[model samples]
Target: MAGLPQSSTYVSLTTFRRTGEAVPTPVWAAPDGDRLVVWTRADSGKVKRLRHTARVTVAPCDVRGRTTDEPVEATAVLLEPHEWRQARAALARRYGWQWRVSYASSKLWQRVTRPGIQRHAMIRVRPA
Candidate 1:
């Protein structure tokens, strides 16, 4: 866990499917105490995969999903909505206006594409 980048802007979040396939994605991550907070779409494949498996691996990566460091074994959990405020606040602090603009844009897009339902979900990752 100590090896995982605490300040990395993009982390390759790899989640396991029920069939044990590894799906890796490049996502924004921000440190929150002992864990990292990741914001992603609610219906993303990674979120669906995590619903069935908690095993995960994370590494610092570029915008293209190419990892820049060795991956660290970890566990991930879907966070409850009540925890989102502070989690998102952490991201906003770390990413500054970019985070705000990106998130607001995502929400707006979601309203147009998938209205009347939550579009974003938060995942908390801890080094195992």
Candidate 2:
């Protein structure tokens, strides 16, 4: 991994409130200092649930292929437009990851960029 970007591959833990249960999704993510950022559609359930609770947990995978279901406790918050841009760039640089659904897509660009539909939220997880 000589020329590859040196960064941790983290498993982002985000939760949501279901009708009568709790839901969680593990996403590949990038870390910036104490902040862990992830991008997703604003209409996503994760975004909706986060508004209700900002507490989150983030954990980096161990080199030995080991990971506990429970994550390190941390607080999370949303990112703004400008910050989102920076985070996106950082993510691309670190992991070469791209969003399959983008606000720039012709199919539903408007919906993706809408204030709260696909543009209302950004994930920012921090230390507890």
Candidate 3:
């Protein structure tokens, strides 16, 4: 399993719907040993789709999800609750200060606008 370049910051993650339709979303990803880890909202469509199937495709892309490299076949696994903290720490280390600021801002905003709505999950992607 070849890892993505160290400089790569974003990845386009494609998951399939029950009807076989492809849905692509650009997300921040950080290499975690032999796998890639991504953080997202727990109730997001991608997370829901992965519950049905792990099959997925990943590609280097810009922030808008425009693929900049060939897609790679992968399998995605939702992390357990106990692993979330480590995953968040890994993401903070990979993204540096920006992640800290963004996470803080998100927390503040959620508290102000939608209290008790902060549910998040981590997904691990391994090359197939």
Candidate 4:
């Protein structure tokens, strides 16, 4: 990984659609070794895009997805369940109470909206 920002509240994760359109979303990310770990819903559009391609870009950004830094080209991979847990643990260590609160609320929201369908994903991004 090279030139990937670590000191940011959020980052704009840009994923490409099958039509080659860029879709960027601001997300909380924590550095994990040489890569960055991002927590997100399993069915999010970014995950859908990742299913087709690993190519992505990351840049420091605001919560509203406005980029504040140059984008770094990267590749992302969806973690398996066990790896997801490990990756989430890394986020919890980095984000502390904020990660805990967000996790709890997301679970509650899932219960209310999707019933027993609780699914989440951890993305591992390696900058190029």
Candidate 5:
């Protein structure tokens, strides 16, 4: 799936379940050489699941008038701060203009309201 174009691509990450199987969440991701990177809230469910397992599935798709799902498995790693910054910069460049808010403002707000104020998680997924 990493070979596919970055646009219109979404990933579905799965973790173990005591019953049958867990439902997969849709994620936007981009490939960085052999690893794939995705951004999400640090305290998101996906991040919590990653602490339990490192395996996941990624799919590249086209929305067209409809949607398609092409699944592939990969082993994931949560990027350290430095790696997250680099990956984020790359993504922002590809996305063109950056988000208007400054990091300092975000930090200040996080110190207050505290919801979704945590750092973003960069999950690196290597093809399995």
Candidate 6:
């Protein structure tokens, strides 16, 4: 599968429920070899859905989750803790300060609001 557009800052990640309903979310995506990596909260709906099924769809999109390109059928794998660290580092390199600020802000917000929220996870989506 071809890599995402160079100019794209976000991608719409679509994960499926057991009932096959699609849940789409806009997320920051970074190229990693043959897959695209995304960092998200561990307890997020997408992560929960991925636990039941690896099938997913990805497409260039705006922050609102509106697709800007045709979606690509893919399989999403949840990374282990160590791999999550590598993915986060790679994403930080690709996005520079933006990733850092967003990550820190999210952590701060979660601490303030959720108190005991789970740590974040990194997901790798490869072409199906």
TM-score of each: 0.91, 0.64, 0.86, 0.89, 0.69, 0.85
In angstroms, the error of model 6 at 112 is 7.4
lDDT, candidate 3, 65-86, per-residue tens:
9998888889999999788787
For candidate 5, write residues 1-128 as lDDT tens digits.
34533555555555444343654666666666666677777888778777777777666544331226566677777888777776766555444443324444656777777765456678887888
Regions more than 4 Å wrong, model 1: 111-115
Model 4 global lDDT (CA atoms, 0 to 1): 0.90
Q: Report lDDT per candidate.
A: 0.91, 0.59, 0.86, 0.90, 0.63, 0.86
lDDT of 1 by residue, 23-103 (tens): 999999999887899999898999999999899999999999999889999999999999899899999999999999999
* Candidate 2 wrong stretches, greater than 4 Å: 1-10, 16-22, 60-70, 97-120
Which candidate, 2 or 3, would have the higher lDDT against the true structure? Answer: 3
Cα TM-score of candidate 3: 0.86
Model 1 C-alpha RMSD vs. true structure (Å) is 1.5
RMSD to true structure for each model, in Å: 1.5, 6.6, 2.0, 1.8, 4.1, 2.4
Q: List the residue pairs that clash in candidate 5.
A: none
How well does candidate 2 match the true structure in TM-score terms? 0.64
Q: Residues 1-128, candidate 2, lDDT per residue (tens digit)?
A: 11111245656464646443545565656666656677666787878778788766555445442444445666668787777877776566656624433434522665555534434456777677
> How does model 6 score by TM-score?
0.85
lDDT of each residue in 27-127, candidate 6, tens digit only: 99887776788998898999999999999988999989889888888999999876777788778877999999998998898898888865788898888
**Residue 28 CA displacement from its true place in model 2, Å:** 2.4
TM-score winner, 2 or 4: 4
lDDT of 4 by residue, 65-124 (tens): 999988999999998877777788878988999999999998899898888874788899
Q: Sort by TM-score, best first: what order?
A: 1, 4, 3, 6, 5, 2
Question: In model 1, which residue pairs have backbone atoms overlapping below 3 Å?
Answer: none
